[model samples]
Target: MKVLVFLLLIITTITSKGWAQDCLGMTLKAGTSYEMSTFNAKDKPTGKISYQVKDVHKEGSSTVMDITAQFEDEKGKQRTPYVIHYTCTGNELIADLSGMMQSMQATAMKDAEMKLKSNKLVYPGKLSVGQKLSDGQMEAEMVSNGNTMMNMNMVMSNRQVESKAPITTPAGTFDTYKIKSDMSFESRVMGIPIRNSMQVVSYRVDSQIFDIKSETYNKNGKLMGYTLLTKAN
Candidate 1:
């Protein structure tokens, strides 16, 4: 269950800075689909997730896309469904933070109203060696069924572009920027403090606003799991 929480914290929709139109360059071709898989530290398959482009609308220089994400359980039954919007205008790509966290809050607390105080970074306009960008902060409070449940705050202080490389996977080869970030999370429940942090290495490609691959680690610096792009168009 803890693993699940760690994974959901980074369940990002897209990338960018300052409400800029930053995107993963993910093919906005309508009707195209991509499947990504999760693997444990040993490379054992654990779960599957998919994203599909539902619609695309061109509004002058910016393009708006409707995307649906589906998560399946071990038995292949869809357990989670979410929808988000992305705008590709300017030189960057941006995602609706409220929209991106809707599903996450729903999963975290049933029938709770959520307000996201932190913004998410999906992509930036540029990347270079040793360049670091602030990914921003996310804070939310959840009250479920009239009971005050919990509050969460996570901050991504900086993202450093480590290098550019060609990553080959089942989906194909993609030119990617390897970006690293340190994220800290804190929560309070019944006056008990829960704190943790993790290291993330995300492979972002010019072809998509979504990460081509993502790796996660625990605060102890142990590699816990990773995600791989299996199919994308």
Candidate 2:
């Protein structure tokens, strides 16, 4: 009888933890593709966009992601191409630039690690949107030169727009989350102070039992982009 009670307690704990995460971590291999659209200052359709396969990798907390992405300019010229190496620990995600990551100037990856370890903007409870039914919201910050650079709050709202049950695809099986977030950023690039606001709706798929998909929209309710993530297996 004592043994039975202990087993029941263990099961309960595991169940709770599993349901607590919207994007529970997974270890698998995958290929990802992304499309980016550029806009003009007047909010006019610039008719300029680019697409690429970011990378292929095994993804999880103990796993590191190898990423390569390319961006194009208004004239269809390649610009600001980057390769990134990153890992996710629970809800916290960190990335370090590959090859010559750290230079005379600090890299973005270094800043991400410091911010995570110090637990600055990490929401302590369940992540949700605009005063929903969850305990905690998603938070993020930027760090550079081992100093806090930017702070932001992420709140997810609305319901899953597609696929009610967890989805299973070639990428992997994952639970899906359709989230809308408000982003604010402050930075100094080339000695110029910059502040901007971004509103996004994302689909966070927990790639343990299904693939995740997110479609982003702008403040004017215009479709911005969509992301489809397939876990590497």
Candidate 2 least-lDDT 10 residues = 5-14
Residue-level error in angstroms, candidate 2, position 148: 15
Model 1, CA-based lDDT: 0.69
Predicted candidate 2 versus true structure: per-residue lDDT over 76-166, tens digit per residue:
6653444444454555544342211221013244435323222111221233333332212323345666766544333333322322345
lDDT (tens digit, per residue) of candidate 1 on 108-152 = 665787766765555666667787776756677777677667677
Q: List the candidate 2 regions with Cα displacement exceeding 4 Å.
A: 1-61, 72-76, 89-175, 189-192, 208-233
Task: Name the best candidate (by lDDT).
Answer: 1
Worst 10 residues of 1 by lDDT: 12-21
Count backbone clashes in candidate 2.
Answer: 11
* lDDT of every predicted structure (CA atoms): 0.69, 0.36
Best TM-score among the predictions, by candidate number: 1
Q: After superposition, how far is residue 113 of candidate 1 from its true place, in Å?
A: 1.8
Task: Give the TM-scores of the predictions, in the order they appear.
Answer: 0.82, 0.39
